[model samples]
Structures are given as C-alpha cells and as structure tokens.
Target: MPLDVESLRSHFPSLASGIAHFDGPGGTQTPRVVGQAIADTLTGPLSIRGSSVASERNADQAVLSFRSAMADFLNADPSGIVYGRSATQLTYDFAKHLSTGWGPDDEVVVTRLDHDCNVRPWVQAAERRG
Candidate 1:
C-alpha cells in the first residue's frame, strides 16, 4: 500500500506555509500535536523529581512516562535513556563519560559533516584526556 502523504502532512501545522522543511542538526518542524503535548506538559502540575509528596510524585510520574516513551521509540531500555537539555549537552556528557580511559594511542575522530555542537565537545574531551 502507498503511504498517505496528505494524511501525514495534515498533522503538521507548518505545512500550511507551503514550505517543505528538511533541516537537520537541529530537528525539522514538529507536528502540531507534539508541540501541543510539550505545552501541556509544561503547563501541568510539575515539581522536582521525587516520590515523597504529591507534586514530587507527579514529577516522578512524568519522568517515568518520558523514559518509557523514549524507550519504546528508540527500542532501548528505559533505564538507559538519559535526557539532556540539548543535543550539544548530551554529546558533551557522553564524550566526557567515554573519554575517561583515553591514553596517548587513543584518538577521537569527528567528521567534517558533523555539526559544530557535535564536534566541539568531543574535541574538548579528547584534549582533556590526552
């Protein structure tokens, strides 16, 4: 069966603008439902993560739901899902963790096609470890 292009396009509010976005590095235009979901989460009952109180429990539930959803999307374990504020931050954190045992013979290779955000952190981590 052929994909329903019109049906899929309907969910993206940006489609009305007559521009087909193919941006990368940062994500492309998101669907209206996804944006609305983010707005709803931010507007809902929220607090620091914990289980001792109602607000905290609410926060904990949100975290759990996030991990579960991401795990399902990525086909990975929920416990392994680590959320960061940005892609750059996530890359930096991962590089720091991975570079701990690096020595003289070790090298980190970053491609020219990579975004600066992806390249800079790994370079810094390699320098620190070297």
Candidate 2:
C-alpha cells in the first residue's frame, strides 16, 4: 500500500515551509513529535545507561528499546542493528573498513545516480587504499 504522505507531513513542522527535501542521506528535519519527545526525555529523569539505578535502568531500557524497534523494522537481529549520525557517516565508515580487502585493480562502480554522500565515501576509501 502507498503511504499517506500528507498524513505523515502533519508531524513534521519543516514540511510546512513547502520545501521538498531529498537530502536525507546526510541530514533531514525530524518530526515535531520526535523533537518534543527528545526534549521531554532530556528534561525528565535521565541518567547514564546502566543497571545501577532507576534512572540508569530507564536509560538502558530506552537504548535497548530503540535497538529492538529498529531490529523489528529491518527484520534483523537487535545485536546486528546499529545507528549512526547519518547514512553518509555509516557508508563512509563501511567503505573505509571494506577498502582494506580491495586490491589496486579492484574497481567499485557507484552510479552517478547515487547521492554524493554515498558515492564519495567509496571513491575516497578506494583511493586511500590505492
């Protein structure tokens, strides 16, 4: 089924500006409710994530719940699910890590159709390896 973009837009205040955003690979405006939730959490009884105390346990649960939610959404193990600042950062990090296995003759084909954030990382990583 197609998603209701209009319905989704109601939660994102940035959409009110009538600007179309396609730069989500690097950064994107978060929904207003998400921003509100974050503010609420920060202002609430938050503490370092651990099993030592009530606040700590709350923090730990938040982290674990986020991981679990992401895992369920992706249909992957929670242990395998990871979050980064942006797709650009994750792609760059992975490219750098994967480049160690590439030989001088190895070629990576990143289409021009891809966002620059996706293309530059691999190219830079491969160049660094070479």
How many collisions per candidate?
0, 0
Q: Which residue segments of model 2 deviate by more than 4 Å? A: 1-7, 45-48
Per-model TM values vs. the true structure: 0.78, 0.77
Instruction: Report the lDDT tens digits of candidate 1 across residue range 38-127.
Output: 777778877788988877887788788988999999999999987667888998888899899899789888897777888999999989
lDDT over C-alpha atoms for residue 90 of model 2: 90
User: Tens-digit lDDT track for model 2 on 1-130?
Assistant: 9999889989888879888677554236788877887787677777988898878887777778878998999898998877655778898899998999999999989887788998999999988978
- The candidate that wins on lDDT is 1
Model 1 Cα shift for residue 7 (angstroms): 2.8
Best of the candidates, TM-score? 1
Off by over 4 Å in 1: 15-27, 52-54
